[model samples]
Target: MRTTILLLLAVLPLTLMAQRWHITGFGGLSNYQGDLQEKRITTNQANGAFGLGVQYDLNPKLSLRGGLVYGKLSGDDKKNTDSFLVARNLNFTSPLLEGHILAEYRFFDLDNYRFTPYVFAGLGIFGFEPYTFDTTGQKYYLQPLGTEGQGLSIYPDRKPYKRVQVALPFGAGLKFRLNEMVTLGYEIGWRKTFTDYIDDVSTTYVDPAALLAERGPKAVELSYRGGELKDGNPNYPADGTVRGGSKVKDWYYFQGITVGVRLGSGSGPFSGGGGGKRSRQTDCPRNVF
Candidate 1:
């Protein structure tokens, strides 16, 4: 970590000199998709995300950037009519705290327009929290089976799943100089995570009876509200089961598009330097008539 900080610091001056240091922030929308209830569900979800950080110009051709970003992804799921007799709805929301270190290379730099186009790729770390809400308006926490408990939503007493995973962040964007001291840009990127439980859905289906037997009535009701009971007993196989939990290895991904402006010193590749007739004059010098 110290080495990483040092490396960033070492490149700071170069970025500053090249007019590369920028304070950027952005907000955008994203959707969550993948295995839910044994079916692939893609919902039109809305997301908002923003970041604040500085970029270092390694040179006119390359640069590095890092920032702290807070983002959310949410959507709703409907039960599959064919496989399950119960009618239910699942809603989920995940807020992530992410940090990204990216390397950017510019493809075109138009001196006349003061605009640059670039592409970037990097790694990030994210904190994930996933929650489930049932039709009854009650919320139940879920955990991966066998990690600390026996079944899904079984331990109502336990906390939600919190994990730290590595992420791959890649995207492209364009920057336009508003002036020497200001710049504006827009970016679109995708974050690929290592965890499969972003939506609180995975590969295996749960036996409703077995889950209820372990979790009791409160949990069963909370997780399966608004659904018809084809089976009378929680352990009875005849009643439809909750699909998901068989380990198929899944990951959560979110896409972001942002537009923001930066404020900084106007000295760099586009500033044209500080030398002119004004340099020879003191404060408010007047021309002799």
Candidate 2:
């Protein structure tokens, strides 16, 4: 991490010297697509998101940006039309914080055109902790409970997943330059994640007696919530019965407006040292005047 930071510091000045710098801010909504979600994408549980970033226009066609974003995501099986899902009765909410760096390609030049459509792809590292409220309205974090039998000695194959994971972000948007100093745009971006546990429901059911004894009753209660629904099946599934998808991973998306403020001259000599003749004034200028 130290080496990476030093390298970025070394390269930033060079990038700034040759390119236009824009400090950007983002406001948008974020939503997730996971095992509990009824569809791939929807605004049902979308939450507000905010971000701040710095963009460098490398040239007319390419640019680079890095930013930090904060967003909230959630999923609930109760919202689904599928009967099996509604019976699952699982729900979760997580606050996601991410840092990303991306390379953007613009289809048109901003110098001559007022607007341009651009696409971007990048990598990100994000941290999240899924949690939900119990029937008594108490909040319980899902991970440490070993709801899916994770972290239990007997379930050697099921280990606790990391809270911090990586993601691949790619999307397209349109940008409109409002003036010489300000630019406005909107974008919709998707993050393909590596883990299926973002919603805290993955894999098969664990023995209720084992979960109750090892992690306590709350663990078992939150894990299998089917009984909580009205006239819902109260019997717990067998130890190996499927509780959630074991194969498919999860995804999240962000869509919003962006505001950018341009910094420095668009076309100017390098801010860093450049070879140029220095100007000098004549000493006799006062006498001549």
Candidate 3:
């Protein structure tokens, strides 16, 4: 009995030192630049973002984490010069408040390497706003005008628009345990947004002149001159002969990648200590976005 008591005492400190729950926080710089559909227009911008969250180890092989993230995404405008000559030079920015829940599985746990690799996927929701400027030095909230003969319209009365959309986030990462309580790691992830109008442009139409007036023309011309604009014909061919009938569609998509770090405690059920053990370890859950 005395020998058993001594053994329990020796194991108590190690058990207490084991990590069961961990809190992680990190900040980093990110940038996104890409085209929408076949539009030749390009968007490029850089910004900083951060995340804070907590993780609970259900066992040595599996864990769950939940956290909040804040960030911004901006891009260049698309230029439309078909039947409707709407030359839009716009930029988009969003203050995203997101929450994510992820399950992680450590695949490679070696003593000398002390590195664990994992994959995770989650969902997020965010707020978005897009701003536009024309060649005539006008600034407006609405998309560029799509009118015939006349130039871009300037609509100042249009109320600011905001929308919430679901986001799919998934990626793989590597974590090197610097110590029992501290982990240094890097992650690469992709976020896919559900909204197709992140650029603030969609299947909407406005008078070019009115839009230009609201948004000063800085050499930008929003004019419609195609068969579709003239007689409401959607079957208008792209022949140079067709005149005075074109409309602009405000549709776009958002995609980006992020890198960050995580920190947490070392006490866990499967840290080879006294906590309950898990039967049949499993890999990380797949992305649900």
Measured by TM-score, the strongest candidate is: 2
TM-score of 3: 0.55
Q: Estimate, for each residue in 34-88, the C-alpha lDDT of model 1 and write its tens digit.
A: 4443333233555766777777766555778888888776645544443342334
List, in order, the clash count of every candidate structure: 8, 0, 44
lDDT of 2 by residue, 1-289 (tens): 9999999999767755544778999999999988888577688889999999998877766889999999999988888888998998999999999999999998865554567899999999999999999998999999999999998888988999999999999999999866555779999999999999999987899999999989999998899889999999999889999888868899998999999887754431232222222113322221232
What C-alpha RMSD separates each model from the true structure?
Answer: 9.8, 10.1, 10.2
- Stretch of 10 with least lDDT, candidate 1: 280-289
- Cα RMSD, model 2: 10.1
Among residues 3 or more apart in sequence or in different chains, the pairs in candidate 1 whose N, CA or C atoms overlap within 3 Å are 196-250, 203-246, 204-244, 204-245, 204-246, 205-244, 209-234, 209-235
lDDT of 3 by residue, 50-120 (tens): 77788766666576777877766555433333323322233445455667787777675411236767777
Per-model TM values vs. the true structure: 0.67, 0.86, 0.55
Who is ahead in lDDT, 1 or 3? 1
Q: Considering lDDT, which of the candidate structures 2 and 3 is the better prediction for this target?
A: 2
lDDT of each: 0.56, 0.85, 0.48
Clashing pairs in 2: none
The candidate, 1 or 2, that scores higher on TM-score is 2
Q: Which candidate order results from sorting by lDDT in descending order?
A: 2, 1, 3
